[model samples]
Target: MSQFSLSNDNDDSGRLKIHLNSCYLHVKVTRPYIIITMGDQIYQTSISEYPDGRWNEGFEFSVSYHAQLFDTIQLDVYDSYMILPDRHVGRAEIRLIQLQDMPATFTSFYEVWDKKLSTGASSHAVRKTTMATNVGALQATISYRFLHIGDPQQQQQQLQQHDLDRQPMEDDLIFRKHLQQNRDTADILFHKYEEGSHANMDQLHLGTQGHTESRTTSSSSANTMLGSLGSWFGKGTASTSLGHPTDPTTDDLPTDILNDIDSSLKTYPLLDTLGSWTVSKETNQILRAIGKLLAAFGQGFELSNLQMLSGFAVVERFYQELPREQRTWDVVRDLSEIQVASHLWRYSMASYGWKGLNFIGKGNGYLSDAIRHHSDSKSVMEHLSLPPDDLLAYEFRNSGAFRPSYFVAHDPSTHSIVLSIRGTMVRPKLIAYCNRHSIGALYIVGHSLGAATASLLTIMLLDYMDELQKGQSLPFTLQCFGYAPACCVSLDLAEKYKDHIQSIVFADDVVSKLCYGTMMDLKQMIIAGAEAAQNLGISQFLWTGAAGKEKWKSAFEQVAECRQRCIDSMENPRLYVAGKVYQFWLDPTPKNPTRIVVERTSPKRVSSELILKTSIIMDHLPTNFDIAFRRATESMMTEPREQQDGVLDQEDESRTAEQELKHTSKRGGTDGSPMIDEQYTR
Candidate 1:
């Protein structure tokens, strides 16, 4: 009719409709599930087993279509889902078709996300190789391809160190970029010290080129991670999954999501009479989560390590693999800049403009809790996705596969685990994929782009305590943590996220360095000496509490001295590294600006560097037992405690610093606001 046919529009199923657009769609799709709910990208779900029941059913799905004023549009609904009434069980079959003349946007999504991507492979794959490239004016251009590994051990060590090294450098880049993203967010917490934040705040006035990080000899961790490589892309036997898709512009959304909603479970709250829905569902959810934890426990099922409980096998894996030397370069290798940035932007708790279109007032942890919350609520399953028009099903509980964020659920029993982590900036749409696949034990960890997502989500989670206390929502019980990350939030935000996130801080790592200066002006400190250690900007860099700093300092010192004495220490961070990161904060100010001052009654038996290093290296706590590190140290070693009474504790000192910061904020943020550093300003 009207030269438009809905009959052969898609596949044999009556669900397909033809879109009129010019598209060069040559895609080889092995992946069959059409992910219709998340953002624009579609991901291949990794499952441990196939589902006994339909994955999607009774789930309502929809798509927005604009037909010319009087033009007509057809809605085809095929394959259906079936939910077993009153049993907390369901089944689904999605009838999908090969994509052709797909909307330009859909085709682009296909190229980046589907199994069939550029050249041949689906650009959407983590193992995709021979992908297309888009080098914008941004330096994110790929210069190198792959690095050869003589041995796996060497490569693994390189990978871990590589992550560590690039972590700081990349953080610096993001912080700088953050400075440009709406100046309003740059509000200096210089007074940050006033509100429980202490012992840090320093900056490099624009054009101030006083020092440079002397390409610290070859022994640096950054150097170890890098090995000896400077290029656009780091290729280490690039088989495929090119890491992250370069662009979603050419990606395709799987067409499988256009199936019919099951007839039985049409009501909201999803199920009519879920057998013992109250107890079984709750028990099963915990069970499934615990199984995942056991997966994380692996051999550690017997170990009582609290850190290991988090399922860090991936970190162990990263620490186990990767080239070390190339990590020193300015740009760290990634799946794709846009995907990473987009994901970061999309999930940013403080996203701006059109980027966070659907996230209106949504907190970061939405994805993490979406499934569980929906299961417990009247989730009719919103049919809208990115372009905000499409439906798949009205699921009782959306699969973890539908989620674009990361997740890790643990089954406290048996210590089994399941982790769902999206690679790179794409945020891989984990929920839907997790649903399609049986995640034995789920554990998820993401960085940079992933890190920010995690941070924002966690912050919002703690913030949701109000809802939980009011009984509006079930208390989100997933144990989650973020490390060396940035948040689209601040310390004051803690009240909101009090119950949700645990953050890890690495000493001297400038992860959150860009948030402050004069009063939140990001100067970019664009200058020659900007990279040098002598101009350390610790005041603005250290986000971890001073107790954290002190703890790290003590552990590092023990480890450093242990290693120097040729003592065996597996956890000790390399010494040259401790000094480099610590020294990175050289008193740039004329008067010990941002200096982590030290006091001791014992005549300073141990160097502050060693003190800090051992604390981190040995990973000890309650350093008060040792004079060199504790409050009693001053009286025991170099000077008497009474003699150094003027030297305030970390907290006391922070209070004093804030009294000075108020006068500073009046001046302004970064370059435009002031000409001199705070040491000079104060």
Candidate 2:
């Protein structure tokens, strides 16, 4: 057998350079992922030895020539590295090389081979075979000789920026010019230092035995210049620099690209008139803006389902268009009557928590199995797939144009079942189900307007405590809950119901704090002093059970450390003000805040100890953060529906025992006072 073999030549010594074509790559191609490797395959050559006086050309040739060879890194894993194009791998070329074994890092592969054999310009594809394939036939070493060539096209795709490789604009030119100038200045100074003109330069050039530089006035001037240059470079754009090797002139900007972006911005007018529209009407405009964004960003095939977002937006805008005389951001109105929609669910659908479970074989879980399993939630909305417990939608469903005959009622929202969405209705039905079953212990976890409703319900129940206590009977039910209670409610309203509700605050979820009049600065109340960290009571307040103990402790320490940094930065206390709010529901107290935080209370109808949503306010706690959210939101039922008999639906099983709620105009009573007397019973 002819002794066939691969070779690795590494002899890097004393400022040595090497020349090689782009084909000299160790490319590992798999179907999905392609890895390129640069190795010690280059024979001894110098960058300065280019045929013409093009030293810079030699550098460009080295990088670009190498880059172009990997025009296709199609992935298909096989024995060694085969050059099979259709070999189960994706289309794309990759060049792989080692960091250290490129040149002068290994000995000669061929003992007597000539140094410069067949050395002209040649670059198409590199032949790569594994070490195992090298064997006795081809003696090859599996050294860390690999070059990592990134896929610019793929990277552009990942960024979702279509015009990444497009011609540069004036902005790009400015940014790159700023970058290169700074570097050029740095090199010039380094050259001066080597000449030993500055303070102690000779020592730095030599090391411990040498001097650094002389502190001359000129040196100070040079140093100041460099400092300013550095600042300028940093202020300039770096991430936006997608400059090509062949630098384009300032006039190279594409006219069409600018025109496209200009067209898009025209949609959202920066200066719009504030007119006599009601608050709901104003909200509708904002919802419409968001809908436009969804339509713009999510246009591809995979995200075609996001078109539902458009419908969602329209629905929300329609809801906001509701007259303020009817109900301003009222959850009860939406749930009790399908016609009063301000589809605040627009925000709720996009990112409100745990809504994707509605498609699991027609169940009331979370998301539809389609979405939970599919990448972008299923092609259909999981929530829309689910039937809500609310009965109010029944009337709307009976309407000519807005009927929901598509979804079946394997599960129905009957008034008899007091907790959760017992039925499968469309949007109105779902809301009615939630409202109907949510009479006493209605944990209303919602966002945006939905969150506002949750807040209102929380306030109503707390304000009507006597009514609620009697209706729930402790052995019976609890009232509704909110996620990020809406903006319209005042801080006074939030505080009044603060004792009865539980809130999970996102450190970054500024929605509630921004919307509501005030935020409970628990950062100060709980994380101000270092001494507040070590208190076991605080630990127990946030975490208990064997599993949560260590994490709770660690998170406490992290929070403590972060707080110290904030405290140290006294002048700019907001340095750590970026910490997000988790959730702090109304403290169920009279006993103690800790009792509510720890979820010490047992379920009224069940023997299980309830899980109260509390988190260790720490540096990075995403998993625990999510768990705490669910804990605070567990056992949440949907709104109830009106009974078919036309009497009206009851929220809790014991709801009838409580007083009847007044119409929206007089919900709080004849004086428009807000009360939850309806949820409570005598």
TM-score of each: 0.20, 0.22
lDDT string, candidate 1, 123-200, tens digits: 112123334532111000001111123444334443443555457577546543543332332221110000001111
Off by over 4 Å in 2: 1-284, 287-355, 358-442, 460-478, 484-491, 515-626, 629-682
Worst 10 residues of 1 by lDDT: 189-198
Candidate lDDT scores, in order, read 0.24, 0.26
- How much is the lDDT of residue 16 in candidate 1? 23
Model 1 regions more than 4 Å off? 1-233, 236-238, 241-449, 457-476, 490-494, 516-682
TM-score of 1: 0.20
Q: What is the alpha-carbon lDDT of model 1 when measured against the actual structure?
A: 0.24
Model 2 over residues 524-604: C-alpha lDDT tens digits?
A: 212222222233343454447785566445544443443344334332111111111123221211111111011111111
